[model samples]
Every structure is written in C-alpha cells, then in structure tokens.
Target: MPPFAYRRSAALLALAALLTACGGGSDDDDDVGPATPPGVRPVAGAEGRWDGRTSTGYDVLLTILDTGETWGLYHTGPIIHGAFHGTSGSSDGQLRGSAAMVDYDKGGQVHSSLYGGSYVPQRQLQAGFVFDVFNGSYVAAYERAVTTAALAGSYTGYAGGWPHPLTLTITPDGGLGLTPASTDCLVRGSIGPRPGGRAVYDMRASFTGPNCPLPHGASVAGIAVLDGPRLTITSVAPSLVDFFAFQGHR
Candidate 1:
C-alpha cells in the first residue's frame, strides 16, 4: 500500500468524492510536524480573512527530496495533502529505476508507501505526470493518483460555474456520495475492487465556485493513471489547474 496515491483527487479538483482526509477522519494539524522526518517541517505563511472576520491561514511545509536533500521541491506550502507527484530526476534515471522518492509529514500519521513521482534529471526534478481517472460522471466520480509514499486517497472534481459550494464523498462501500446544490438528491455511483489492493473509483465533479453561474454548470471529468494529477477544465475560461505542478512539496 503506497502513499501519495490520493493526488489524483486534488488535481481533478475532485473536491467532493475523495480526500475526506483533508477535512475528515483527522484534524488539519493532526499530522503536521518534524516527527515524520528529520528536517521536514511546517512554516506558517500568511493569515488572512476570507470574507470579513473569517480568518483563513496557510502554512508552508517541506519534505525531503529523493536525494535526501531537505529542500527538494520548487513549490511552497499549504499543499493539498497527497498532491505531490515527482520532485527531481531524469527520464533515464526513472526508466533505469534509479528515480527515488520519500514521504514525510509534520506528524507520522501517514504510514503506507509508494513512489509518488517520475524522474527527469534534466531539471534535477521529476516529471509532472498526470492521469485521467473516471469512475462515473457528473458529480459522482473518482480521480485517483499518487503524490507521495505516505499519502494516497481519491478525489472528485467540479469546474465551471456552480450554483453553490459542493461537497463530495466516497462511501466505504465504493459508492459515490454527492451533495449538490442543484438537486436535493445525493447522486451516487459505484466501482469494483481491483487487484494489487487498488480499488476502482468513479469520479464525481461539480463546478460550484462562488463566482460561477447557474446555467453554465461546471464541467468535470476523471483521469486516473499511474502518473501525476491535472485538471482539464473549460470554465469561464479554459484553464488547467495542475495542483501537483503548482503546489508540490516544499
């Protein structure tokens, strides 16, 4: 059981279906600290207000690179959990099997492991690989991928204009769980188990940004592969939000 598999959830912006770990089963600060690794730790970035008095803050965290080097990533903190793909290496190093990766957190909550990224020695970093994983469609889908050795989960993405903020979830029974604003019903989907301990998933996506509209519903899709995480959304404007590439480990 490898970690970092949950990255697919975020890139798809699979906000609803997967990654309950972000705000579920545990607290945000539960596993953040130096206990996970020697030098990898958290650094508070900025504290700001969302609307008026709603204080929202972000923290910058860093994990070890494949080289055991402390500063392994080019991106800063407030990283979405399980969103790291690869750091540094060359294509040859990866194909030759020398590409390396490790997982660490402020806390040691993450245990299982996997190779979270591909290598690209040219830039002394890994390749920004992404997958298109789809379980169902619309608001109930699953985007699965790897970010680190210690992190892995699923996610459903929603893009475009949404009527309201949406919530997505995956039931223990492998059923899609959706809480959509347009409908009172909880849209559901299902997937079967696969070999090697990897479960098949359906991606659920919604486009419910505060600024989006109603008629122009968000467009969502799933791309699940052994690659990195990415979003191909044609929203108010066509945009690709590759969270893994933008906000990798520190």
Candidate 2:
C-alpha cells in the first residue's frame, strides 16, 4: 500500500467507534492485566509464537502469553506497518477474540476488531477479523524456542521508514536502550523469555524526551521477534491509542 492510502485507513480508524458484544471477560475482571482490555479470556492451547501472512498480503507475527494477553505486528510495505493487542479464548476447537490496533505510520490512530477461527495446538491457526471497512483472514504456523543469546546485540535501522536512522541495543541480561539519530528521544525497555520458551519475547518499554512519539513517561507493552539477522519489536501505549515499532538488522 502507498503511504497515503495507509494514512487514509488510519483516519478511518480514528473516526469509527464500533463495538460488538460477545461472551467474554470484562476489562474490570480482577485477573485482567493493565494492558489487556475487555472481551478477553485465557483459552487453552492458544499461547505461543505464530508466524504467518494475512489475506491482504501483510506479513504477520503474533505472540500470545499464558495470561491470554496478545501482541501482533503486520506489515505489507515499508510505510504500512502497525501493531495490535488482545486475547483469544477457545471452545470446541473454535477461537474468538478482539484487539485494539494502532497505525504507527499514520501517527498512531487507533481501532478495534473482533476475530474468530480455529487452531491446532503446536501446529497452525486460521482466523478472520473485521474492523471498520477492513476485513481479512490469516493463517499461521506455530514456532518453538526463542533464546536470549540470539537477541542480545546492536542493531541499526529506521523507525516507520527510511531517512530516520534508529539504533537499538539489547544487553545480555535483557535490558534495552534505543536512540534515534539527531533526536532527543531515548527509549528504555526490557525483553525476557516468555513462559513457554517459544519464539517470542515479552517486552515492555517507556518513552522519554520531548521529541518522542509518545508522551514522556508513557509506558507501553508488547512483544518482540527475532528472525535470523533481523529484529522486530511492536508495542502499544496503555491507552491503546499510540504504538511504537522498530525493524532492524544486527
């Protein structure tokens, strides 16, 4: 997709306020984490790392925590990247869920959607979702084992698109630091092995400085994936209205 077209979708997301009622837990559920919203449940056999592609041709990487919190990243073009977070529950081999998504390329416009599908534990997942005027399906295969040794390094790349250089450093102990060229924005975060030891890492970060996309002192939650020499991180603000993503190579 062209940059303008992506921005147009972001605008639509910002203007639409659609809600669907489904049988699930509420945001106020005592067990729900601060990062998880309503309509989420901890379903069996749905926690792991999934790699796939959407019907719209976007590459997708998704992580579902044991606690039912979900984080996902999708990209079709350099300027068409975004992230989503929610949870999925299963019943009789069917999966149902919802997520709040943010378009980082368009200044963090937010939207929500509902998804349903089927899955085979440790094998594959297929799901379809609708949000605003957009509808698409995705299929993913499960991946296993992600080690910190593979993630500790220095990476250089762009944030959102080229011409804006960004540097990321991950310490052996999972500490993270990010610096964007010629900018005061310095991001600090942490990454650690998830419960299942799958091809996914738990990630939490905070943005600081006047030049940052998110307000200073804002904390975001998400996940990270390492693909050979490349690293991808996708995170969203607590309000779910803003997101931070990075793609780089060691």
Candidate 3:
C-alpha cells in the first residue's frame, strides 16, 4: 500500500472503532440499563391528607404516608363507622392498594378488599373501595407540623358500642389516658409525631381492666390525625379481630 493511502485507512479504522464504542454498533446492546416497569413510576403529591366522601355518602379521611402506608376512616356525622389500613402505590396519577377494613358499627367486623383510583397532586383523589368509591380533595391541614403539645387536651367521644361517653386525655409528653364515663374500662398508650414530620402521629396502646371490651392486655397499633378541635384515632389489634376507632372533639 502507498504511504498516504495507508495513513488514511488507519484513521478510518480508528473512527469506526470510536463509533462502535459510542453505541453505534448493532441494536442488541447488553450494556444498556433495564427499562422501568410499566405502571410503576413514582407519583408526586400522592402522599398527604385527603378529605372526601365515599359513594355510600359517608365522609372519609384518608392519609397516605411518605412510605406508602395508608390509614383512613369513614364516618357518619361525628361518629367514626369504620377504619382501614394498607400499603399503597401510585404511578401516573393512578393509585392502587389492598387493605383490611374494620367496621366499628358491626363490633369490629374485618374485611379485606383491593382499591384503585386516580389523583391530582395536592388537588383531589377518586378511588374505589370495597363497597363504595371515594372522591376527596387534599387537606392542607396535613402540611402542618404535628407535636405532642399540639395534641395535649381533653377529648370527648364514643368508642365501639360503649353506652356512656368516653374521655381521652393527652399530656404534654404524649401520654394517653382513655376512660369511659362510668365504666371500669381504661386504655393507656403513647402518641408522637411520625418520623417524616407529616401531620400525623404514631400510636400504640393496650386495653386494661376487666370491663374493657377487648381482652385485658390486648395491644393495638395505628395512627392518628388531628383536625382543628376534632381528633380521629384508629388502631388495630395484632389478631385483626378487634379495632378501636374514636372520633372526638376537644
């Protein structure tokens, strides 16, 4: 080969190698990362407080934590009728989950159901429930910070099937004391702001005294949300057979 021709050929080969290294070769490239799964993309503004009404006409309060754990309640008037807890996920304005619902009106009857819906971040959510569908708007109250002192107060309300009034007191340190107006039942627990600083609290409590509808020493775990003078609490037994839901006003 001639000297100039040989140099041109070498430059051409180097250019071809550079192009191949830059992903200009065949279509089957094993170095590429896997594509994201369909319908599993992260959704912004899906975690917050949602206030809405169910298809059954019951008012609902739903809270979705940053960790995708969900807790909610449905009520008629000021009395909480049922509560649910489950894991949720959202993608492209779509929300889906499966949860266990406990009916306080029916002596804590528990049912499992799957749910799905659509959402507009910080705007609204429309989801289907076991027996009804929910349409709710975002509650700005959820953006407020939660603290033990903010929740320290006396609350009056009703527990499941309890004939008398119930009193729930929270101390400045987040200690909880619950007592029926004229009954021997007593519940003791602790509450505190959730880790992510959202407007919700983590609660763990146990029933005590013989008159308590739940077995003595039965423990429950759940979350709580405060709305102005009203406080709503929903906790579930480890056995899933019994639940405690209280809607009270300070």
lDDT of 1 by residue, 1-250 (tens): 2223336544345323222211101112211112222342321111000000001121212222223322111111323222222222223333111112222232212222122232222112121212212111111011111122212333344322122333444444544334443444333433322222221222334434343322233433232221133211111111222121112110
How many clashes in each structure? 52, 0, 0
Q: How does model 3 fare in lDDT?
A: 0.70
lDDT string for model 2 (64-126, tens) is: 666777777776644436777888776554566778876655556677766666666545565
User: Which portions of model 1 show Cα errors greater than 4 Å?
Assistant: 1-91, 94-125, 128-166, 180-196, 199-219, 223-250
Can you write out model 3's per-residue Cα lDDT over 7-92, one digit (the tens) per residue? 34544453344223311101211111233234533335478778878766788888898888888888777666778888888766
Candidate models: Cα lDDT each? 0.24, 0.61, 0.70
Taking all chains together, each candidate's TM-score versus the true structure is 0.25, 0.70, 0.78
**Best prediction by TM-score:** 3
Off by over 4 Å in 3: 1-45, 180-183
TM-score-based ranking, best first?
A: 3, 2, 1
Winner on TM-score between 2 and 3 is 3
